[model samples]
Target: MKRYKSILTVVAIAILGIAAGAGIKVYSILHTKSADILDAIESSIDSGSAQYAELKEQGRFNILIMGEDDVEGSRRSDTVLFATVDIDDKNMRILSLPRDTRVQIPGHGVQKLNHAFAYGGPDLLKATVEKYLGQPILYYVVIDYNSFPAVVDILGGVEINVEKRMRYVDRAGKLDINIQPGLQTMDGKTALHYVRFRKDALGDIGRVHRQQQFIKALLKKVYDPRILPKIPELTAQMMKLFKTDISPALAIQLAGFAQNELGRERIFFSTLHGQAATVNNLSYWIGDTKAANEFLNAPLEMLISGDVAENRNTNNFAGLSLSYSSAADENGNGKASGTEKKPGQVMKKDELLDLVRSMPESIAVLNGSGKAGLSGEIATRLQKIGIEVVMSANAKHFDYKSSNIVYPINAKPEVVETAKILGKLLDIPSSLIRSNNQAFYPSVIIGHDNQKLMSRIDKLIEISTQ
Candidate 1:
């Protein structure tokens, strides 16, 4: 239900529910007594130039809509969609970005896209999407679902065609979703159940499609002229759910659309095209950059600066990790409700070679066995398998019996995993993996066992590459 509430939050999200009447900012309906709620929405940040030349040049205003799954007090973004609000055409384009889409997060290794929200909140999420889509996102709305079901109830009941019967009970979420097949009128809870169900074959991909469908159904109810009399109630429901940086003028423009000739046809849907691959035995979707851009009709350069997101890569030896911080508002104002957790997950090399490539690691090889050129030879071998050789030199001593990988305490997730993989490849003892917090690189000191390690390294490189 937390995720469902989150979805309701994201449903305003992209839906055009009107703002409040009289003189008031759009998101000012909060009734919280807590100082924290007041702090979270008290953003005085100027979103953009009064108007953006990019919007005029590109013919669309990009808005990011994200919904968090507050399950177990974990705040990973459960739903992420880029809403391209085209002003000139008076249309909408929502591209549902998969939560698992492999993309680079600034200051972190390449991992799932949705982790951005969990780590840095909406600001980071906007930045990540802008980089991925190569566009400017001028506004966003994050809903807290405490009073969300009320919004659905106020709209009467949304008419939806059930694809099939759905029956699921989740104790953790305290959700009981059981509905028979065919056309139905779903109340707030039932509607939430319908949209949040994902036990079927297509999994998340299918759920994304269902979200788009639920949105259209919800919009149809919103467009009904009967809603005119209930404008006050509707406005309050919307205001309470949304948290955004949208300018008042843009909000008004969006509200004006309901009184215009806008229809469901104007809203198009898109999602990232990618394949599922295992990284460290964890499932992540390797996004198809070309396909994502093509679907959106906007190239990367058109949306992001320098036309790139640096942390993302399409190469072998690229390490991976999801950096989801504990529950907290991206803004410093909101505190996480849960206890502290570890920085990232431990990745294990999967048994299959079909696994996706990882982010790169800086590897420095040093000869310690009085071998004059062994370091350079080993460096060349490592490079063939995608581990970059940043430095190659002789060790201070020449009497070491075995080589080992050294990682720093402050090493990034990718570096740690890379060192472990390298250790395994070299048959380095677990005890030999030194935690050198001050080390600049993941250093490898070649010992007298170089010949034996090299023999294994050569075979490992051949297998890793092909």
Candidate 2:
């Protein structure tokens, strides 16, 4: 019995198809004598339906990709990914779902996410994912593992830096993986083995990471000039390997968009937020619904701009509310003397300095104002007040309206308190200080509204130093 798990290859095939179309377009443009190639490109483009145009006009859509495996006589999805493609913004965000994640499978009660495929194939899996994320899936692609290697071989292999030596043998499954570490180009079979080897401590999570890495590498290979001439061949091969609702014309249109507009910086990847738990003696990854939904509903700006930390922790602040009655409330306790301070009220300068000095964690400062060097400047001011600045960089895009202090959902009370105090010190509204499960650390996103606070922060720094 061979166990198949070539999940990322499904995505690679879709991307390859798009890349092929893009390459053909480029090739046709350069070689006018290739009348046959040019005609195919024209025909694909002309075949676009009104629905496809409407979807493009809608600006964004979700796609679900599943890698199916036949075990004994039942089919299960070994890997599931939900993708949100923002057309107008030229950004693509993908969230990988662990196969063992516990979910409500329609007509089957509660079961592993992968079990949905065994129950009803792609349609049920799509519905399960949509219900899980609270969003509609517009398209789906299902690819068998057997066809994955051929696509990689077609591309002449992909370059990947294997982190460690991998050796595994499963005679029962007819699987034998042996790969050396470091940078190497992998052909179809080697790449499949590379992604499927999951005997390490991280298990499936590690495999997911490897798959993501492979996807990126595959994308790079797809754009390689050497692959341009092989576009037609690759496209035909991919069409035969995958089952998808996307028509040839729509795929070509998207491929053109990806090649022409989507850059490496615009692509983002994340895993479904969850925790490993044992239920009824069965190990399962319990999905964090609130945190996952928040992540999915998060603005595209934030997703594209912020780094997706590998070790994500969930904090559910769903119904919690905070009210500050006085300066003492900044200490994480609501009890305080004197007149009640409103949510956005500024704390005394001395108090703000004390809070900054007492912060328990370092913070990453991001310039969401679109201004160069803004984060570094703020970081300097923060360091002057004894706050450790761990990272300083520009947010991917800079259209933020106001500054925000963000802490992880499961952040320590002191950390949350630090964010609130920092917010007051910087004159940011209390509402702007909130929880974000994706935050790697307590962070400050300096928006356009806070760009003018340089002088104010300078004065505070000077006074604190004195």
Candidate 3:
């Protein structure tokens, strides 16, 4: 009970803890020097209206949360979380969508999820997330990290169990982070250092765990009664630190309902099931792109009241294990009247990998093995995923024994994993996967033992559901 699904929300709430409680804590601000913060809270309460009456009449809603750094320009959301809170069941489920996950933006083809934020702000990011999850999100809250250091310092400091020694220096960030491994208390500045230190092998993903740790520590402090009298001071520093659509009226109204109607609520946290892969030599997290609504996103009940129990995920909130249904949709109904698999071998549909879209931007393929038409044959299969083979010519000398990828530039911005995934589909070996930035795409050299790989793909594609 009383769990925070994401550190962004926890920080926003803790920084402005008392304001979130509506005016119930307004009286406690009388003794503090934070009169300015009290004024802002009073103003919000005064300007608020009962817009959540209908939501209260029912019992659940979903929120889309975006968390970003406090930097000035070229801002991209660092965090994207989808939360579903069902007051009726006293349960909350949260799904954290990684910023680097591949998604199809409205005007942009498949790109990193965070690009939506940079391209169109939260609204576009929301739309992109909705498409990925197979649903829509109406509520949102954005946490600004600029004033976060102040909040931690105001509460004296927060404690964290540093898993390992972190030492990273970034002159541009004016960041020189060096914290030893141990259980210790970190001041505001040091706490920022701890959260932003993402130098482990895990990369950005590792930073997520650090953020979670900080939230746990911050939550412990929020629960401490000593912060009660100083709520106004914290709220003052935080009132302008966040952006949300939550009206003061709805916040207070929901607060009362959450405390009374929903007692000892249960909260669940989950993230997308995927792995970090190099796409075109660039790093990205990729997963099954065709996951259905039930498996990928929150149910409609998450954003509205009077939702059916089925949509609340009451029986299936244990974790992120997803089971596929060949014939059923999220509502336990057929996908469509004529959508069932036709009972036949659909010709021209025999491919192990479906090219997501026929993107023709910056991808290439070549035949390093001199067998005539070998390059064209492989390009056909690659096209299924919507990849138009940019270069399908033979290598300078066609005396190679295997196929591999090459990146002419540094691997930092190359799409490396695309070749690996294609290799799996094409039954290419990992040893054949090279990382020389010599070619734009992968070079496929036909080997004498390539027949076995084709047989495997043929078997997979020929299998019929009917």
Instruction: Identify the leading candidate in terms of lDDT.
Output: 2
> Residue-wise lDDT of candidate 2 within 381-432, one digit each (tens)?
8888778889998764576655667777556887887787676677655545
Compose the digit string of candidate 1's lDDT tens values, residues 371-461: 7789999999877766778999886567556666666645688888778767655666544555443346778878776887787677666
Residue 27 local lDDT, model 1:
35
- What value of lDDT does candidate 2 attain over all alpha carbons? 0.65
In model 1, the worst 10-residue window by lDDT is 323-332
Task: Give TM per candidate.
Answer: 0.54, 0.61, 0.52
Candidate 3 lDDT, 1-466, residue by residue in tens = 1122222232354334323344455333322222232233335432232314313433445678777774546687877877665543334455667678888899998899988988888788878887787654546777666776887888889877777899999888677999999988899889988877777776666665466556646655665656766766776666655677665544444444333322111333444546677888777877443432333333221211111123223222233222211111211111111122222222233343243222224456666557788767766655544455666776655544434444442234335655565555555545345454245554454443345444544544454221
TM for candidate 2 is 0.61
Output the lDDT of residue 66, model 1.
73
Clashing pairs in 1: 10-13, 134-303, 134-304, 135-303, 135-304, 318-358, 318-359, 319-358, 319-359, 327-336
- Deviation in Å, model 2, residue 362 alpha carbon: 40
**Winning model by TM-score:** 2
